[model samples]
Target: MDIKLWQAIIYIVLALIIGAAAGFFIARAWFKNYLKKNPPVNERMIREMMRQMGRTPSEKQVRQVMSSMNQVK
Candidate 1:
């Protein structure tokens, strides 16, 4: 291919890559902020349970609940 064609292709590919990267980062940041502001109610329930029980819930318990919830789909 000619140099101009190759340059145009490369520029298009670079622009796409940069746009995708910017979108991913922006989404990640936004979701993180959203989660912080509104945490999952189930997780909050678990935290409260741990406080009442005077012990932290095991990782297994948390994972089990999360997996079960996911499996409901």
Candidate 2:
């Protein structure tokens, strides 16, 4: 069976839209899973980092660093 020009264009557009939607959801789910496995920074991580840097971090210093990070975001 032969398709008309407009019908072919409609089918192509529909395919593109469907593909884009599927790609978006797949990427989003993968990103969420990746973040779940490798989560963002937290207070404990900050403290450990400071310790590794050879600095004994005080509570106030950690909180200050956290606040600064929050402000940047």
Highest lDDT: give the candidate number: 2
- Compute each candidate's TM-score over C-alphas: 0.57, 0.84
Candidate 1 minimal-lDDT segment of 10 residues: 40-49
Give residue 69's lDDT in candidate 2 (0 to 100). Answer: 95
lDDT values of the candidates? 0.85, 0.96
Over 1-73, each residue of candidate 2 has an lDDT whose tens digit, in order, gives 3568889999999999999999999999999999999999999999999999999999999999999999999
Backbone clashes in model 2, listed as residue pairs:
none
Over 10-67, each residue of candidate 1 has an lDDT whose tens digit, in order, gives: 9999999999999999999999999999886586577677779888777788777777
- Measured with C-alpha atoms, the lDDT of residue 2 in candidate 2 is 52
